[model samples]
Target: MILTRFKKGDLFVAVVTATLLLAAGAAALIARAGAGDPVAIVIVDGAAVDIINLRDARAEERVYASALGTCAVAFEPGRVRIAAADCPDQVCVHTGWISRPGQSAVCVPGRVAVVVRGDRAEVDAIVG
Candidate 1:
């Protein structure tokens, strides 16, 4: 019987290729799972002004000059928009919907920012 052997360099290359493929698969899975989710809320001066939901929406409404401090963010279904803000720039008002994890919209003058956070649970310690 004859046996075929793999050289050290060949084995190393094979291992590296496997590792790269695994990493690519993991990245794809993460991207697919992270699509369209609400990640965070931005607050201004101790009040919540914006709520960012990472999903596309049909329509967005803006409400300004309200008693509740002049800035607010709202989300409906797969859509997010700045509902209100005291800032004159009104840039956040036009930010519109963000339909992916890690997406964000901000209003500088209002001191409000919204960002997405991952859903993975923290692993505090490992037990042997």
Candidate 2:
């Protein structure tokens, strides 16, 4: 029996192809596992107000608290937005819905923060 040997270039290409396939498979698994789910919105005043089992949310819904003031978080298919706010700057309201994991909107004056929580934790920082 005769055995065929792979050249250096052929071996390199095979290795690269295997690595790519593995990476693709891993990414697909991650995406499937991290699929979207219903998230609760916690409005913190002097006391914590929990809005549970919220499936669909609208941009028109305005959230308010005595301590945190007023702010609105809009919900889309895969995201949430800050539609309005009682704060002077209104920056938080402008931030809009953050669908990705680890995304947040904060209104200091209103003492309000909206964050998207997901199953997989995201890295704190990304370096290019």
Best by lDDT: 2
Give the per-residue lDDT digits (tens) of candidate 1, residues 1-128.
Answer: 22266678888988999999999999988876854354455565557654544344335454433333465666666545576677788887788765444555667776666544435413322345
Model 2 steric clash pairs = 80-97, 81-97
Worst 10 residues of 2 by lDDT: 46-55
Best-fitting candidate, measured by TM-score?
A: 2
Model 1: runs farther than 4 Å from truth?
Answer: 1-37, 45-69, 120-128
How does each model score on TM-score? Answer: 0.44, 0.54
User: How displaced is residue 67 in candidate 1, in Å?
Assistant: 14
Model 2, residue 42: what's the lDDT? 49
lDDT of 1 at 77: 63
Q: Assess candidate 1 and give its lDDT.
A: 0.59
lDDT of each: 0.59, 0.64
lDDT, candidate 2, at 45: 51
